[model samples]
Target: MSGRAADRWAETRAPSLAEIEALADAAFAALPEEFRTLCAGVRIHVDDFPDEETLTEMGCESEFDLLGLFRGVGLAQSGEVVSGQMPNAVWLYRRPLLDYWAEHDETLGHLVTHVLVHEIGHHFGLSDDDMAGIEAAADDITPSEA
Candidate 1:
């Protein structure tokens, strides 16, 4: 047998929201082109945590309760925009995401995609079943097997 000893290493840097955002962007880009086209105008944001006000408004007892949020008019309500309307926005809570990461074995990109798709499901006024099917289909394409 060889005399070589095993080696160990550690991550020298801590992960930040920006890092997660970059990963999320790549994951989103890797999504089926048709899906990307449909979400072309939507904005995705990453923050360490939601503000106290947002938590209250969202009826969450703790910040970690919310992993992601969709804060804009759905497709059904988009036509109501008269003028000076803001574009759709989606917020991904990084702290919560990290908390989830600690408990799950999946990669960050996959988690972000799951949250993104779920939020987009809301944007399209899709029912729970509809969203489930959409997520299942996305999984078929991407295969969370990673």
Candidate 2:
């Protein structure tokens, strides 16, 4: 195995929900200021697996079908805030994310960032092409650049 691969195997354990949440937070913070500014008031939640209702609602064959989900009115569709509107939120599935990481060649932080950007893209009413550009822009930002 490569040095990096060996390093990962040194202490094999799934990242806890809190750890995933931290990764999401770091990923969001690393995004460009313009992108982050548009995501104001969004909340993030991390769970092991999506609930049964969400599974059926999303028409998924398995819990692993979804890595993340966005629930709320898109920015473009928002008119006026009601008296008691549920805040827009993003839900990240920890087990599904970990499973995808094990099967892919990317780092966990990168994956979390990708999902975060994608969900936020939906909020901004952006097309897939636009989101791809944003992801590319994000990929260009190294830790030093961030």
lDDT of each: 0.76, 0.87
* Cα RMSD for predicted model 2: 2.7
TM-score (C-alpha, index-matched) for candidate 1? 0.79
lDDT of 2 at 61: 100
| Candidate number of the best TM-score | 2
Q: Candidate 2's error at 139, in angstroms?
A: 2.0
- The regions of model 2 sitting more than 4 angstroms off are 2-8, 144-146
Candidate 1 ranges with C-alpha deviation above 4 Å: 1-9, 129-146
Query: How many steric overlaps are in each model, in order?
Result: 0, 0
**Which residue pairs collide, candidate 1?**
none
Please give the TM-score that candidate 2 achieves against the real structure.
0.88
Tens-digit lDDT track of model 1 for 1-146 = 33332221242344688888886676566666666687767899989999999999989998899999887777856635446778787888988998998799987667887888788777778788876665566666664532
